[model samples]
Target: MSKADVVAGIPGAIGGVPDGMASGVLAGVSPVHGLYASMAGRFFGGVGTSTQLMVVTTTSASALAVGSTLTDVDPDQRSGAIVLLTLIAGAMMIVAAVLRLGKYTRFVSHSVMTGFLLGISFNILFGQLPSLLGAPVRGSTAVAKALHVVLHPLDFDWRAAVVGLLAVALLLGLAHTRLRTVAALFALLVPMVVVLVLGWTNIGTVADTGDIPTGIPLPHLPELSSLSVPLVAGALAVTLIVLVQGAGVAESAPNPGGARSSVDRDFTAQGIGNIFAGLFRGMPVGGSVGQTAINQSSGARGRWGGMWSGIWILVILVALAGVVGRVPLPTLAAILMVAAARSIDPDRLVAIWSSGAISRTALVVTFVATLLLPVTAAVGVGVGLSLLLQLNQEAIDLKVVRLRVHGDQLVEAKAPTALSDNEIVILDVYGSLFYAGARTLQAKLPDPDGAHDPVVILRLRGRTSVSATFLHVLGDYARRLDALGGRLYLSGVDPRIRDVWTDDLLHAQGIHIEFFAATSTLGESTLAAYADAEVRVHREQRP
Candidate 1:
């Protein structure tokens, strides 16, 4: 296992350099910050991460988020702002873990995430076009800037274009070969060497972005006075992006030990990683899908693979820090463009398009928002899309079925649209009865407006609790039935409901709802309630 960790760590470390620098470039920060994040995140986040082989590191999504966050800040102050943002986002993650909010990540919806990721990819691709083309362009968004470069090709430096294209060609060429593991390094080295040897001084290089320190940076504190409303909000956005992406990473690579990974614990692990990253003067980091794939493919069996990769990356950074500054900006741009291109999964996009109207809407809206809006704003839009989808699903999921006793067995059928006089109707509710679900039930249930003396027996057998909205729906139904001398009976209900305020609340709402406790035998309580309803109907008829 130790040997496997060491073996896996090597490839991960090797990829971390270019990958890390690319993330930093994405974040609009110094490339070294990405390296620092790679080291801190892998070491600190992996220490107690639930997903053993999941490599916590700087991710494109988070990097884009950081770029959007500091878009307005002065360049000289971005470093401090980035550090502060990382720490704040990390703290937020820890709070989420403590509050056990990880389970809600599923509610984000696959369609929303897919759209957001697609948006991030396109944003990266379009944003890097200017750098890749070495074209002087200015625009508010990536798409806008790329358009300027395309609309006016005269602004492009042909020399830089050639180098960038060469790197891209190399990436595509080496993708399928045995050297694919180190393809990025090869691409970087080849194009950079060509430019260096030819003395293509016109090509933009890493030195133009920011200064890269020669050794590991010392821990530093963020500027407390710089905290503001926008900064906090940006931190919140970063927190959402990382946690959600981390959840996907955990799902992508299941733990090899057969143990289910705890999402909350993973959240805390990422929090620890970001804290260390900030303290060490690094950028924000999170669970990276590409890096995790490298870890697994390289034979990592446990957390040690990620931890060792951190050490290896640090060693590399210290050894080759000076050379990194000489790497052409166009090469890094090409690497990022290729990576982002691959990140957009066409199959998933096609599936989302075919899923249904609701899913398609989510995907399209989120995707567009990602391209047009700032990274933080796009995140908010994604979250809004997820919530809307969840509510919509709840509405669609609710079902009302009628149950009839045919001899000793109960047969299920579609619920009636209206009830008849002197009738006994048994309804079984399926799916959630909260919020939109309960409102959907209101529409699906039979109309009591025209019915006289119609007894409604609702089976709530496994229900342990009821939402206020559902309770209100029940009260309204009971009141309508009571007006016609009919009664609403609840049978096979969980015992706890009887002791809760729900029982008293029903009476307080001016309706007497008969409650039947569930029995060991299935449908026994319902049958008993039915028998009592029969007696009441028969007595009314005789009178």
Candidate 2:
């Protein structure tokens, strides 16, 4: 590597190493696993991914979830399960790539992203509250622990806590001001210096970072005998949520020197990283948005930035392993808190809330899910709620109107008065015809107990395709219309959908087809039909 590459990569790798180790500790795993994953995963992903600055680490959300799920399992079982899930998730990603499932990742809307990140910010912030107060490292969830410490801070080491708090303040100040790239190191070191120099409060203090193992992690079979179905399900959910979040980070981030990223290439890189991580008994790896932003802001030039960092981390660990163990936990928490604070995007949250009720609802759902549910389950719940809200919105958008006869003309009570109660009644479709949306159309039809109007007109300018259930329902409606002394009229259909209708049995029922252009003649055809029907009505009245 070039001199610049060495300089940039060393710091990046060092920064990544601590975070990864801490994350593993936080997730109730051995620190070595975190190191192995960071070293190997970063190299693989960095080389393969399009975003040169992108880094992968254990996320607070995923860590919390993994901790919760694995905390109850026996040690052997937990290790086995983690390995199993890691491999499974890696396999799933490969399958997704093969099947071109990348499109699904795009479906996670802006609201979900904003809500998820905001929730994470809160999680990280709340998690650090006890540490800032000099409380013991305890509690499963952030809020619970914060409350516990607040209600009763036991044997609080005021001096050490002060050092940690100061460190956090410095880091935050540096980040908010001009000097953000070196914030992590400053955040870690300042507290160390304060504690070591003054010998303040005999709390454990680090002289330097600890030695790193020289060799790579040994491969061992992860025990799977104790793995339950629900555990596997939760792991799968975690993997999916991580993938979704990672893809967003990859797609949205600028590459080295402020360039765009190729999402596919990024995914390929992440896949490679995870595969290596699995081999090394490490958990799954994905892109870290905060880390990427930090690297970009730090003036990293190319992939060498990450590669150099990896090498530097290994060297530093070998040299400073003993010193690293002396590092205070409070200081680490403080640094994490500062990093979390920087990630808070209040404006994005406001935008999501302002978009509309549906988006607002999705945000609320996701935010609440993250707070209330276990980490792994939270993703599933949030995504489920978001999708459910979308479906409900589509349902509301889908509509059906009754077209009735008035002396030899059909008319519908839709906007723009497409038909003049003369030729046909237009049921204007404004949304998708998915499973949930199909109900709205079914409800708007005339009751079977009464004599229905003849020649029902279905203005299909907006409908793109029909599901099996939707097709079946429409077929039923068409059959009913035919039996009720009426015929179905289809207009304003795009050729793509028209082709399906032509081949489908639903179109076999007696119906009239009109090439009403949605941009033009759809309204004209309805108006002309209504006008002709009005003339017929007048003639019948005269007789």
lDDT of 2 by residue, 1-543 (tens): 456766777557657766766566555665555666676667766787777767765565565566656767776466556666666666666666666676777666668766776676677777777756677756777778777777776556787678778877877778666556667677767777777788764664433222334443456766667568766776676567667767877666666466777665666677777777767777766777766665565556777666566666666666666556656667767766766776777787777778888888778877777766666667777667667776787788876655544554556654332222223345566567788887766776544334443444566665566687676666776666556544455555566776666644444654333344344543555545445444544554463
Alpha-carbon error at 85 in model 2, in Å? 3.5
lDDT for each residue of candidate 1 in 446-538, tens digit (9 for 90 to 100) = 888887788999999998988888878888898999999899999998978777746556667796798889999999999999999999888
| The 10-residue segment with the lowest total lDDT in model 2 | 415-424
CA-RMSD of model 2: 5.3
Q: What is the lDDT of residue 139 in candidate 1?
A: 97
Name the runs in model 2 displaced over 4 angstroms.
1-7, 50-53, 75-84, 137-140, 176-179, 193-226, 254-265, 301-304, 399-422, 444-453, 459-464, 492-543
The TM-score, computed over Cα atoms with residue i paired to residue i, of candidate 2 is 0.80
Which numbered prediction scores highest in lDDT against the true structure?
1
